[model samples]
Target: MKRIFKFIENNFFVIVILFVAITLLYPNIFSWVLGKVHGINIMNLLLSIILFGMGTTLKFENFTEVFKKPKEIGVGLIAQYMIMPLLALTLAYIFKLDTALTAGLILVGTVPGGTASDVITFLAKGDLALSVSLTAISTVISPLLTPLITVLLIGNHIHFNPIEMFISIVQIVLIPIILGLLVNYKFPDFTENLKDYLPAVSSIVICLIIGGVLGANINSIYTASWIILVVIILQYFIGVALGFVVGYLSGMKMKQITTVAIELGFQNSGLSTSLAKTHFPNYPIATVPGALYSVWQNLAGSILAYLFRKYLNKEE
Candidate 1:
């Protein structure tokens, strides 16, 4: 049973793709997961659980890496915020996306790095400390930066309140993470015991979240897939490529380059989906890109990790 769970966690990108296929073919299968539970969204709750799990693995010392490796972390921070959002904005304009998708894509760009990036970085034999630090710093700051940037990018076109979005992020992203950190702080042994299993659990929940949204938006998938699919590949893969370029140009080492590339490529897409549901009530399609990205980025990152392990590692 433990081996089964470990396999699921390690091969989560495969699991995500399987669930997405099942959801797309039979939306009813996972459509049930998309509804409300006592007026709280199941998707939002599931996403919060994922964030909480992330918080558990983190320690306060993670932030201290910021000071210790300022140049690397600083470069990552600037590139994370600047590269993706600008790529998203440029893609949105080039594709002439609707307000819903424009907002969704930009949100995917603006939010923090994903915990999955740490796994990818590990697989690529990159600097895990730098990856974790980037994720931790970005997650801590996301409540402010995510909403502020989303509104800044899309406010003129969309009329959602940034304050409300900010509050929602704090509720959905920040609070759960803090609670998880507190639980880990207070009950270190318990969290340590669950560490191996949490990734698998989080993977399943993420699959469900993606499945549910895709299930719910079955109609939009056919139409949106045509354009958004192309945009997703471009934005995420280009982000990864350019991130590597950024690292090289910054004179970073090979391991640091791999970490930077992965961090920039993977976004905290679940947060983006939850925020879209809370704020873009009218544009249900806004949640689609996040769901799509939740799958595509992991798949891309995994494949990239393989290339790094195979080709790039030899160079080092």
Candidate 2:
């Protein structure tokens, strides 16, 4: 049982891909499940659960570390907020994507760093503390930054009410995370005991979210699969490259560069998907880029981490 759980934790991206494929090929399965709970904001609920689990993994020390190394964290935050959104907007325009696809790609760009970046940093033998700090800070401020950037970048093309977005982010992300942190602080022992299970829980919820999004947009996905895939792939690699450049030019160490690269490259796509579903229901297809991105970034991040690990090992 333990090994099975471990396997699921380690191979989460694979599991996500399998489920997405299954959902796409047989949308009825998920659509039926979704229909059973019609009128419920399922994505919002799942995102809150995921954010709560993320909060449990965090410690107060993580926030203090941000002040301890403000420069590193600042560089990471700037790179994360700047590079990806610009790259996404540029790519969306260059690709001449329709409004929904353009908004989807840009939405993926505007969100915060994924919690998965911390794990990828550890796997790559990079700066885990820096990764964690970046993720924490970015996520904490996502409610503000995500909406602001989304509005600035694509507001003319899409109907986005930043105020509504702010409210949603607060409700779905900030509140739950704060609750989780409080639980962790108050019951350290209990939280620690359950820590190992959190990843599996998060993985399951994320996969289900992806499945739901894919299932909801199966017909549109069939038509725009290739183009959207290409745009998302470009968005990921460009963010990675620019992250490294920003880190190096800012005088960060190689490991810090690796950490920032991962952070910048991996947006909180689950958040994007959730926000898309909740706020942009009129454009269900807009969630597709984020859903697809959720799968591709993990694969790309893992491969990059492995290569970085091998190269770092050689240097050491």
Candidate 3:
């Protein structure tokens, strides 16, 4: 048993892939949890735990890194905020996706960077500090920016409470992240030593979130498979391209370029899902694109990270 757990710890990505596959295959498990789980708000609780774990991984350096390399972070932030939303809108129109799904896609695009970006950045030999800063700033700014952008871009298609959405952001994202940072500051050694385990726990939580959502809406994805794939790919590519374009235009280095690209390509789908459920309950389907993107982006980012690592080894 100990060996099996250690193996899972060593190959976290493979575990994530297997979890997602199993969840996708047996979505009913998600429903069972939702049905059996009481007022504990299991999903939200798990998400909060994951967010807290994320905070433990952060430090003041993450934020200060922005000042050291403002151009790279700025370009990456612009690409992340711009590319995905535009692509979401365009894809919605082209695919003529269901109104609820269109709004969901837009929400997914509008969301800020996720904790996963930092992991991906590290694995790809990109700029960890820049990714952390970008994720932090984008997230802190989300309450104001995300709601406004969502209202302007997608509110027409779905009803939402910007205020409620903002509140949810505070509860689920900002507050937990702040708490995690405080915990890290208060107990630096523990956080540092426990870093390895955090990844595995985070991976498990992420897979659970995806699984729960997929299980809850398995039929929707099955029915809209092509549209979902198209939107996910479009969001990823546009994000990657825009990140590189902006980084190069700003004269960032190769590593910075890669960091920006990965950061821009992936987003905090968990936040999007929470907002969709809280603010737009009438249109639960609006969370589908974000949920699907969560699964797809991790897979694509893992492949990209592996390829980049191999290429860098050859260059050395």
When 2 and 3 are scored with lDDT, the better candidate is 2
Angstrom error of the Cα, residue 102, model 1: value is: 0.9
Q: Tens-digit lDDT track for model 2 on 1-316?
A: 6677778899998898889879868886665423324665776777788888888878889889878888899888888888888898999889899988888888899999998998899998889988988888888898999999999998887787999999999988899888989999998898887667878877888788788878888889889899899998989998888988888898988888888888988889988887887677688798889889999998898899999889853364
**TM-score of each model, in listed order:** 0.96, 0.95, 0.91
- What stretches of model 1 exceed 4 Å from their correct place? none
Per-candidate count of clashing residue pairs (backbone under 3 Å)? 0, 0, 1
Segments of candidate 2 deviating more than 4 angstroms: 32-40, 313-316
Model with the higher TM-score, candidate 2 or 3? 2
Candidate 1 matches the true fold with a TM-score of 0.96
**Model 3: how far is 105 from its true place, Å?**
1.0
Which pairs clash in model 2?
none
The TM-score ranking, best first, is 1, 2, 3
Note the Cα lDDT for every prediction shown. Answer: 0.89, 0.85, 0.77
lDDT of candidate 1 over 33-122, digit per residue (tens): 668889988887888888898889888888899889999999999999889998999999999998899999999999999899999998
Q: Which residue pairs clash in candidate 3?
A: 104-286
